[model samples]
Target: MKNAQKPDHMSLNSLVNRLKDGRYVIPDFQREFEWSPKDIQELVKSIFRDYYIGSLLLWKGKTENFDALSCEGIYGHQQNGGAEYIVLDGQQRLTAMYYAFHAPEIRLPNRANRAFYFINVDEFMRENFDDAFEYHYQSKRLQRLLDSPKAQYESHQFPLSVIGTGGWDLLKWVQGYTKFWEEYPNTEDDNEDHISAEQAEVYAVNGEQFGQYIKEITDEYQISYIELDQQLGIDKVCDIFTQVNSRGIRLDVFDLMNAMLKPKGIQLKQMYRDVMPNVDWVDTDRMNVYVLQVMSIVLQSYCSPKYLYFLLPGQLKPIRHSDGRREQEILVQSTDEFRDLWDKSVSSLVRSIEILKHPNEYGAISPKYLPYASILPVFAALESHIWTLPALERLDGTRKMKHWYWAAVFTNRYSGSVESTAARDHQDVQEWIADDDARPALLMEFENRMRNLDLSREVNTSSSTYTGIFNLLVLQGARDWISGVAPQFDDLDDHHIVPEAWSKKHLPGNTWHTILNRTPLTADTNRNVIRDRLPNQYLPEMFESSGEESMRSILASHFISSAAIEILMRRDFGPNDFEEFINERQRTITDAIQDLLIHERLDLSPRLRELDLDIERVELALRELVATNLEDDSERIPSGVRQKVQQRFEVAAKKDPSLDPENSRQMSSLLPHFDIRDIQDTLTNKILWPVFSSSFTSKSDLDLKFSQLASLRNGIRHSREVDDVTRMEGEASVLWFDKILTK
Candidate 1:
């Protein structure tokens, strides 16, 4: 019997050919293909990522066995009478591979239309797996795109059907794609729709790179299989198949745990069923697994599937002592003790969900808005422990937990490998809750990420940051426009502040769909009040009905400041107004996040960052003025000023040996080091005054602005205090310089 079966592996290329030739067959008892396009897309991603796609169990087919269990070819495999192996397991994965590789015209499971797959070469080059692979159902628009090679090349989307044909097909496609882009300029206007040589080269390089990856994955990637001998009797094969698949399903870790616990008289499934009603508010696909995870976390401070075995009754757990010593101990000595832990985990999870759902608290109005369900077990375990602290300590701990939750969500800490991150966060957050100084490292990371985060690009709702921002908007008591009251949580919809219909028609950019332009509004308000109208068209009507002052307060709840409201109220509002409004709202939203979630003052990071960039503009203007006029002998720099710079360089050269007076580029580099006053002097010089005059208003105006800017720069550079009024003046000066110099 041992010799009846042997393990063998096949390259992905060979496997695809076998499926195409109808060499592999699925028994009638095997379930039909049930994979969604998303499931197939994920499988493709895994194959390309070199992840193990798991082994197959194939029975060497016999006529009698085929008769006993009516074998059929894989989906979209039209060829017949070539069956060599009968698939016993991994049918879903096998069929998914066939569907993706063959580019079948069959409908996806439960979907209406046939699906087609493509890889976005640009995103693939960036390794953005989430956006790189996509499957689209048949549509006129999609068909048009698929038909046009020029559109395909421009979009960087390569049809996967090319891979199905094998041998030089992908190479030919890549060459065609490259040639199309390289010659695109001949057919298009260079001034309006130019494709630079550099951009065309990028497309060619990405295509060749992608083709190489496809070849490597198809030719070298292996799929192992256990081949059962054909000589085996049909009865034996039937028994083997039944053994592998009982009750039409495979056993997962939870089922295995239940099997292991049966003799100990503990029904883990029954315990989970009992807890389900209590945790009805917590929306998780795997509540049963989460129960075990919470128990594992509370017991051993770990919750990976491997670690869950330690929680089994009488299983040995290595315990660490306060003296840095370890001892082995049984985690669960009896079934009653296991039940007690389960009960406690369920109770704590209930409390955690309550906190998460409470609008005044964490404000995940529903499970859909919850940024990361993977963090729940650790959060529940920690929540239970926090409540056990003294009253004063408990209050502080809860406050810190809020910060930790927001930090984890915004930083996307639990996006991958949730077990280790959850365990680490559990420990780090607990420590942070007890000691104010012991801030979790994630807070610092979140602060750094937020400083440069382009909120306008966060248009995808699936992103953790995008959802976190929505939850924050919900927490603001976002009132309905008509009723001027917070709507029921379930009734609220994430609607666009700047109407998407108007933006699509008027604006050139796609920022209207960004989180910066979205907020929680009641469905009634969205459908009845908003209804495809511009903010200027609708907001004033609401202002007249709700009163302008009351409307301002209501808009403020949605992070719309008075500045943004003014822009939105513009009767002649256009793309610039939309840009200015969203930018203002972004600042207001960021300020709220800093004040509430991060527990810090809204620092001038973005403004200060912008200030630094504008200062570079000032320096570059000075350099261009000096460099352009140098050879012309404009005397922009007087003899006295030249001597002053040379004297300064001599002193500087004595301190630093790298100072090269001979190199023109190195000499020009010293222009950036000149103080603002030096820049003003160079700009306002009598000879250079005419050249700089067109950029600035006048010498007196430049003097007044530059002087204020110099004080602001010195204070900011040297870590000295600058008052609000001085900061505002400095902002004006920076804006004035940026506009004039950038032009």
Candidate 2:
């Protein structure tokens, strides 16, 4: 079978010679040259130190059976039925070594030009080994090192390109050095101006030593290789390649796929390069693996959770009944089928990216904050049906699909176990298209999931999910609070409404990054105009400078309530009043988010009706609680809350001009103008016990129920969608109220 083989040691000189004669070649499946100069420098250092660089694994093949790829240092030539060594492992290291020692110029990662050279070889040998291995690609640094006086005297700065070839001769170099000193003799014995005879002799001796050192490095340095038997099948060769390369820079599934495609004259990497530029929404560097995975998923139809393993050559073996070795099945067989599937997948992906580019639609300006790339396959699956629908129907379908996309993003649908989620969603989408009720059912599922979204707390702007949410909010027509202009998609900045410095000073340990405290602002406004001043000090000045109506428009655009704006305009605004302002703004933001999510007026009546209490009685009870709390003390109500309430009354009166005079009189008579907080506090306090005394066993029990009610009310008022547990607590509170009211 010709299976027995042994490891072979080859010198660098012999390898270079074989490379020159085109006997050594790289296989088509091997990855392209990817090592940086730093990698090459490390290899050279390891060689000089005699450390163990990894062995080269090669496939010995007849020159006629396989065509070799022409690389930087390896070329193609006709062979007369001779054996050629095809590199399977250590392609990167071999390529680096070849280029460093042979190639004149090398192209870097970004297509920048560079050349490699050894600096001060004599000094390199004498100095600390760690510091001796110095190499550079920058032009200015290379030029400076080459032009140094040390380089002139010590024969340093050896260009590696011509080292082993006829272009450079070490013996001739030594003879030239000896002849130069003899022709221009320096007999003055001067230390600086002229070279002394002794210095000249020392230079000659070092030159000879330098020639010998070059010989030792290039000719004497040995590298080991494990050459596989030439008769092994390609599958076995691939398996051996994978096993031997398990430790460092192992072959990815794409590499094996490339190997399979090579026999049919296809390059997988070139295919990627061609398709990537056509898809504008993909970041080439980060999204390449994901793009390949998406193609694999679409072609396979079934979600291979470990797709990399599945695609590996000879990875799937048939079951054996204790009789014989089983033959492996091929996952991908035909090249034409692969090409067709690849074409369809790319076409669908491009269409999906186009769907997200509409300005009035998703408006996905960049891929930086795409929450999940797996959603691409789902959209691609939907594209098959979307194209068949009538124009108007297509528009509607796209809108629904976009809604689902946003929902999945906000809900983190594809976070963990992404492939499993994608597979399930793929089937669900198919069913959704099959049945008419499925669309609304899917949307309801989205809404149900979204109901748990509460932006009352701080959001990390760096999180991809949160970033996508921010982008969605902007797409839904969110405008800057300060400018009254829609923020430029690329230029928006997150600014603290209550400045961070103020919060740290007055409300330490409180969250300063809550959704209510943040607003999208232009970079100029955020950085230049509103530096670190408290809102109370800056907002009033803005109102004065920009006028009341314009300022009101600006605040309204940011979802700030009309009442909150009126409070900010008060001349007696105080720094301590910021907490109340934050609470009010949080409520406004919560309401705005609800509108964005569902695109309809949020109905809490159904949820509230579950309590089965007298509506008028509840309102009257809350009003009475507010009135009694403020009956005696003028200092109890905060000035900001009072001003906000009066502003609401004035604004209401202005809307109905006939009631202006009566509203003025009513405002003067009302001692403490009440807001929602006063009612919430009253409902949560022991003072409300008499209103619901029949429903409770004790004061503590009543307090607990009311506390839960207070929490639910706050969540509802702030526009947060509560979870099932919160809904249950709310229902229980309502039941307690129903019992007391009936009694």
Candidate 3:
């Protein structure tokens, strides 16, 4: 029962004309259009140059419902009933055509005088080069092709690229662009990536545009291949936008969040936008995208696509919704509650992440959500008695508060209905009150399990320390997330500690997952000291490029922190350290548990039951390991292996001790067992002969040994052969500590 498939074709002339007069729209249900004018203009220039590219997105429908925010400034939509297609993918590129052909001047922010540039690199272009023209555009290339377009168009056979500047810089740039595109390259009859003689001739003539050029390209070469399908809608539009765009070149959630908040009222939306970015850590640092994620979670809790809105700063209207009345109602309903909740939560969360200092771990979890847990603080601030169970039980007015909280986070973390509101009420109705004996026991059981899970997952090498920061809040109640923050010990890099570098080496997979590679240093510091710098003997008295004082301050500040820098200086320089290859995102499990506990407590019952049973087993086993005797006479661990392993663990631990597994038993449990055949006698403990120890008393002491772990790790790396003394010593100490803890 589906409509028959048909291929609909519209030429470049019809598509451009349709877009020019505003006949097509992106649709109301579509995601908000976000493309800088410069990015759009560049793409437009590409179209005129006749690049080896094809396809324009066209939705097939007549007067379909789309997002109201999406319809603004778009090409006109056709109502001619026969399979009208919505422009889904090329919204940004198409919008550039509007500004290029229509707008007198473009409006954009944060763009300095990076002017528009057009370069004609053909053999003929090599001569028309003017030194004065070069100085004007800030490029050493020819200008003045506009004056004699015909002669230049016939002569030049080159590829053209146009760049539009952010500000008045574009004036000089557009002039340069005019010269560059004047020469058209020929059309290729071969593969799109390959160059051909026909293409060269085509590109030289039709490449540059100025009203007339659009006509010429339309006549000689270009045609729009409109790809159409039935499943074209708002979601598809958003998904495509997200996919095709690069970071910082697309619409951010904060922008969308503000757009969504607009439904509350422009005043509220503006107020939130103006104030929300003031945090020194979030904005000025140019880091913490987790803040954006929180905004999305918060927005979702309020409403969905049709009714929701965001009021971004500087925009006259709501960015998310066009309907003011419905938007205003949602805004008024959501803002007050969200604000009170956010204000407290952020203060606590900021401190926690800074203290935990795990960028690699918390990279996926947003810092904005950190404030969700602060709902208790908000409640505590507002009413004071809401903390007690009897007071909580008597409270039905707070049900809405609970509802928003659950939807924001709990819904995403768990796969159960046990944490739902229905389940919470069921418990309340059953009299699990404070005075009940069952209540105290339940509280103890809950807290004990939480403490164990927190200790395990938060500091585990594989987890993002960012998630564990919340535990820091619970244990050491800091007023601000950064207040208790220690000096940048230089032990852990927020990654690329030296900051400035050519490029991070390409790993075929996700580079950010590695925690050993991740660091907690500020963006300024991180950017300055990028991966691969062999730490100079001393950080200079003054760094010339950034001219920032952070380097000088950190160098003189703390002894332990200073010592960490020394270790990094002596270590080999490479971006692909084992530290960066992070695998265990162990805290996600706790993140789920904590989120469920706070948000949808009732709906998470089944999940909670599973966690309870699993955690109990882990607790008993850990305690038993701690209780075991570690004295072993049968086989002594080679001192060389133990020392090597100890150093490696210490190196990363210095980067982030909180991420280092807790307790000697926990640390010892992950070590590789050594045997007599594994031990090879060598030099000053640098390179080691392989030795798998036959017997060891400690459960997992090997996991925490840094030196042995790295050296024994089979990799194409260079190292001086190591000795047996340090290895045995490290293993013996691990065994000794395990014995001590057990007794």
For candidate 2, the clash count comes to: 0
RMSD of each: 12.7, 23.5, 23.3
Under the 3 Å rule for N, CA and C atoms, how many clashes does model 3 have? 142
TM-score of model 1 (CA atoms): 0.57
User: Top model by TM-score, which number?
Assistant: 1
Rank by lDDT, highest first: 1, 2, 3
Give me the displacement of residue 45 in model 2, in angstroms: 41
Q: What is the TM-score of each candidate against the true structure?
A: 0.57, 0.44, 0.25
Q: Is candidate 1 or candidate 2 better by TM-score?
A: 1
Instruction: List, residue by residue over 215-317, the lDDT tens digit for candidate 3.
Output: 4554454545455454655465457545645353544444555555566553434544554544443313322233332332233331111112232322232
The alpha-carbon lDDT assigned to residue 402 of candidate 1 equals 71
Q: Write the per-residue lDDT of candidate 1 for residues 1-743, one digit (tens) a residue.
A: 25998999999889888888888888898888887788788778778777666689899988777767888888877746888889998888888888887877778778899888888888888765657888888999899987887788888888877777886877888888877766656335562566567767777777777778888988999999999888888788779888888778645668878988988888888878877888877566677888899999887787866688887889987779899999999989987898888889988888888888878677787887888788889999899888788865675576667778888888888775477677877888877776654666677677767777778889888788898888777777788778888877779878998888888998777878899988888898899879988888999899998899999999888888999988988999899888888788778878788665664222235466456556656656756766664543423465555555655555454434455555323446445345566667777888768866877768998898888788777655433356788788888887887676677
C-alpha-based local distance difference test score of model 2: 0.59
Error of 3 at 646 (Å): 46
Off by over 4 Å in 1: 1-87, 90-236, 239-250, 318-327, 434-437, 508-510, 600-743
